[model samples]
Target: MIKWVAAFLGYFIFRFPGAVLGFIVGSLFDNMGGSNGGGRNVFQDLTRQSVSPADFELNLLSLCSIVIKADGQVSQRELDYVRQYFLSTYGKEKANAIFRTFNDVIKKREVSAQRICSYLVQRTRYEVRLQLLHFLFGIAQADGQVSKAEVIKLRELAGYLRVGQHDFESIMAMFIKSADNAYKILEIEKTVSDDEVKKAYRTMAKKYHPDRVVTENEAIKKGAEEKFKEVQKAYEIIQKERGIS
Candidate 1:
């Protein structure tokens, strides 16, 4: 408990303080009753990654239900996409139980997309949230192309998550391969010179770099690596299109 408090002691102001920091501090403290050792504590402190970050798995599924339902139709493809995401992330034992929870949450009107996004944004770090957006897009694009409704809902969800405009746009660009999307992924103007395009790609390389994520969770770190690879692919596509070496 003292370690948890000391871990975030600087964040607590005279007032209650901000949401993200407050959420992390409170969640860490609250989770203490359930489960560690001094060496484990020191290890976890260095990693800044918990096995389950702020009870995120259920929240992920809840938000996913909102995403796949945007088109007013939930296909088998969409259902399976959610299943695979959970299965791959948490394995069969937990995935089966979590899917049931997802169904229950979807049936209730008590949770809104905004509320789900806000709750997650408050608790987890940015890279994890970025992956949440990534999964949402993956589900939306499962049927090949994203529908207008899904796009609007995704943008709104990103707003709620407080994802930066450029970052959100970059991710959107990656999923939309048409419409000079490579340049969009790099966040460069269509008319930008090759040098400018290279600069943008380098900037994104730094942003999505796996080591930059600073998470102890190997799973989360792998997600970051995948995202970075997406950025690399986008840059390569742009170069191919522009005939740039």
Candidate 2:
């Protein structure tokens, strides 16, 4: 799709060589994750030259560091949350090793949310990306309250990661309490009709279904389960408010 379009535009301007070059560039975009087969399961292409396990761990740590430092004062609770989360996911030895590398190297560098998340946005599945945001929000809220600066940084990271605003808000509402948190969690407005509320509940239930994320990592699946439960709880709250069965 993109390849052919670029080739046509190139030929319209510079003819043969330009067409060749354009096709090459477009192929790269297509291979990286373009409109073609947009519905394809991301896990199906695990063997592709995507980010390795080590790089994934390191990049995750970098993002955590960014969030921890966002408020201009590092909280030990946030750090412990990250460390314990990693320990539970990767076991004690591996988690300690990762933290060592993160402190010694990844933390010292000026991490670019755009650069790191751009790579992940292309390679990781949408569900995986949502889980990433959920995890980051967990870090921000670890100290009992999420700071204004931390929310700003998390929102920036979500934008770079190409997560939709509604999805980001939905995940955020889970951690941050608000009067209309239920509606936000369900990704709907309060003015919607009763039928629309039910419809939205169904949609969100499927979207945040734990089984939707097919990964070997139980921690990732557990994160999805948390989202699933949040969605369910939101629907239940809406049901009670509206007197729906």
Candidate 3:
């Protein structure tokens, strides 16, 4: 009966913080010959080791570094976006540590892509991994443009993340659609009609333009096409509504 009670307690400890800490504590008690033998000692050790930093943080930082470097140049906008996301997702204290770790990895200048991808694969959950990829896409579009280099890097990361090509293409489409919608919301136009459109275009263009969102990239021209279309549409809509045309 005493042995049964001790074994039950051991099982309860293993369930929460897991087998690693359980194993250690259990072993100490086992060494003292207190209870149900050492049935879970091995399991506890295994669980504890499994919770190491290699399981999560390392891989997260590796992926984040790769993402920030997706564009040929890392702009202030990209940095700011990354910082904001980290703060929101991890809270300020942890976010600062994460940013520091990510910056350190990126600054190494000698890290291999395979090494980075391997870390990401080992540490991150699939959904969180996808979110990181989307964040990179956002940074690429932040500058109101996407460069060929940035696109290629994004594609490479997608592949490395094991996300399907179709999904990647879908994400690109979404970015284009968002830029288009933003233009419409601002009521800007392709051509100047009164100083209002010109001013509105300048302001709206600045706001939704990819360059302002990240650093400028030539590849973003394709995404910009949608923005242009939206501007044209808004101009038409406004003109018709206000009897300007």
Badly placed stretches (over 4 Å) of model 3 are 1-55, 122-128, 177-245
Better of 2 and 3 by lDDT: 2
Per-model TM against the reference = 0.74, 0.79, 0.47
Ranking by lDDT: 2, 1, 3
lDDT per residue for candidate 1 within 28-85, as digits (tens), equals 7766634432312101322223435325566676788888788888767888888886
Write the residue-wise lDDT of candidate 2 on 1-245 in tens digits: 88899998888899999899889988988886643332222222232345566667767788988998899877889889988987776679877987887676434747888998987887777767877889899999999999899999999999998899999999999999899999999999999999999999899999888777755666767777899999999999999999998
Cα lDDT tens digits, model 3, 90-145, are 57987798788777877766556676666556644443344456667877777677
Number of clashing residue pairs in every model?
A: 0, 0, 18
**Cα lDDT over the full model 2:** 0.82
In candidate 1 the C-alpha lDDT for residue 119 amounts to: 67
Prediction RMSDs, each to the true structure: 8.0, 7.6, 16.0
The TM-score, computed over Cα atoms with residue i paired to residue i, of candidate 3 is 0.47
Which runs in model 2 stand beyond 4 Å of their true positions?
1-49, 105-109
Winner on TM-score (1 vs 2): 2
Candidate 2's TM-score: 0.79
- The model with the greatest TM-score is 2
* Residue 74 displacement in candidate 2 (angstroms): 1.1
